[model samples]
Target: MLPALALAVAVTVTAPPAAHARTGPAPSAAKASKTAKFPPGFLWGVATSGFQGEGSFPDSNWTRYVKRKATGISDPYEKSVDFLHRYPGDIKLARNLGANVFRTSIEWARIEPRPGVRDPKAIAYYDDLIRRIRAAGMRPMITLDHWVYPGWVADQGAWDNPKTQADWLRNARFIVDRYKHQGVIWITFNEASAYMYKELTMRPMDLGQLAAMRTAIVKTHRAAYDMIHKIDPGAPVSTNVAYGTALNGIFDAALFNEVTDKIDFIGIDYYYGANAENLTAGYALTGEFWKIDPEPEGLYYVLKSYQRRLPKLPVYVVENGMSTDNGKPRPDGYTRSDHLRDHIYWIQRAMADGVKMIGYNYWSLTDNYEWGSYRPRFGLYTVDALTDPSLARRPTDAVATYRSIIANRGVPSGYVPVRRPGWCSVEDPVATCFGTTPTPPAAYRIPAR
Candidate 1:
């Protein structure tokens, strides 16, 4: 177990602390009367994007990042993970673990790189992928846009110009119409706000460009939702908004929130929370490159924060995980499984307190691309993007842990942690003591570069 570096913030209300309560009626009556399973009929799965794992066929915003060498990407944009070929093995990987649901994206750049020219070849590829997922006996969750846009569209001013909305919908409508039969869950965009940073900053974010990009995403999401429902009334359509600072632009959540009434289940992707220090550094809290706070309580507070604003909807923790290079041991010898166990315990704790968190999806099934570098590994099945031509996927210990949890429907009874994390305080819904204690300057996090 790792030793927690404690930090604190002042609270406006000096309130009493809260505790985690077990759910269900009493065990004697609970077994007979328990309304929900430990997972409580909630789904469990993982998420991946087309460009990140699907590998190369065309250039888009992401390929530009690699070719221009904005960050350190050495490969020739070759089929890196080659999930294009390995999805059968990958979906099999998912099913073996008993994961009932899996989320992946439909890359627009691949399907519609040219104006009015739909790529039958690329559509056929996804057609095959969706069919395989059902064959695996797992529900497919599809993300219409996972950050990559067609290269030609990028040249047409990208998100800076509102014209991108028309192009985005063309691709969105094409995908939903083609694959609606899968009985799948639909997420219109991957993480709109975080991409505003990616589209701007990796290209670099200026205030003007950032604002325009955010607007385009909201407009794009609404258009996609309408088009999807139009095609398949049975398809539950929605978009996954990656929660950014203060649980997604505290005030600006309305950009995505406006369409809440139109969505089915909310896919809320939470990688990490931004304490005041993280915001000062200027990186969007999209990927789990840094362990901002490894405490499970942060998960509970974030889930509820969104719930208060978007109540009457069941929330799914769509994407969550820690990134490790080579799965190296953590500061005090914590392994990946420890991270999984702690975070999930907090998830169950959230369920106990009635957050209505419907599912848990790990960030990825295989280590693929992380923006421009292969250094940040978030997959349960690690793929070393360097020195391995086979693109062989290997499973980590966390897989077995997760498999058992899924198979048994919950963590084993009487299971306890090696140490109690300090952030546990946040899980208490009433006392959500944010920044309630003084954090030492020396302990300020050295975030991922």
Candidate 2:
């Protein structure tokens, strides 16, 4: 195992080079004519979270954070996309897109509201959701926690209190016991490192307390992993990692390295990648997520790095998507379909290189409350929950593109990416600068799975 590094701002990006220098790989004199296909049984899906999508405000850490008027950076917590009431329609949307898997969370704050008092109605809501997803011919991927805890848990010293873990497990056991038979994949925690980073930076805490909190999270993950296995031994389980740009190793040290052994498959959530000359990642320092550019090829390095590190585990891209401000076209002019195609191209490349790639899930099925704002939109189906009264699901251009990709088993061989690879991608500096760019195979076409 690698030694843990100091926790810095999550965006510890390296210096970027001049923009003109990195236009992507120079065109090869020769080009391949056949497109490669993903392996048989490769899972394709869309992802959503309970607190982000479920509306009608629940009392929890996030709701409290948004309510604190002193935080000028916060946005008003109006009802989110209302997935709580409209999930049936949404599940149908996912099925229409040819998705084989559907990922969403069981909001801890909602399911077990008010400490030791599990809400029957909340349980019934999820029971129906699981059934609906299966009815649509998609398997459910349920995340136990996605960074929100009951306000009551916050009062009990959050993760700082050891008793919180016990309370969490009691809730976990109940959830797993109920949904294990639905052929669900389990994510013990969503972006564990990001959860801790928010707790450490958004709130006050000493280094000692921070360390204790991390330990508690690992204990909880391991305990839940064991409990879920006891209930459904064949179920796949993991905690997704928010892959930091070139600084992923530094971020992994904060949490992932601790509970690696407990993971049945590696779950990666990749979003941004910084090029050598365009260290535009500096924008993240201001905490504006909309400012970051989408780096589709970065997903390749993320999978390759983990493939080398954890050779035995199959990898799943639990979350990957582009976020446009308010569902608008990017100033850089990248389209969602363009981003999706480029990313898929690289995913096929990685798999060909022997990575045990198993699945890929777009970050969301619909836009929801993104942390504190609705500005960073990362959905194939856009929902203006704040401005629109009806909360309609609007399909973006990527919808047809995704459905086509899923139907073909991948992008067609000989299909060129609309967005070329970034010049000097810091994703893997050595390879980006000195190695030959990988090209599609000329004669080999992957058969549709």
> Which candidate tops TM-score?
2
Question: Which sections of candidate 2 miss by over 4 Å?
Answer: 1-35, 70-73, 436-449
User: How much lDDT does each candidate structure score?
Assistant: 0.66, 0.78
- Model 1 has an lDDT value of 0.66
Model 1 residue 233 lDDT? 78
**Per-prediction RMSD in angstroms?**
7.9, 6.1
lDDT of 2 at 129: 95
Put down candidate 1 lDDT per residue, 1-449, tens digits, no spaces. 00000000111112222233322221111121112236556688977888888876586878888888763444556676898888889999998888889899888888887877878888888888889888888889998777788888888888887778887887777778788777788887776655554654567646666656666777777777778888877777776776544333432342455567777777776655533222321232334364444444356566655666566888888888877755565665555676676567656655665678778888889888887667678889998777688888888888998887777766554444332334213233234333333323333232211
Question: What tens digits encode model 2's per-residue C-alpha lDDT throughout 26-60?
Answer: 32212553234886677999999998988886788
- Model 2 C-alpha lDDT versus the unseen true structure: 0.78
- Give the Cα RMSD of candidate 2: 6.1
Reference-based TM-score, model 1? 0.82
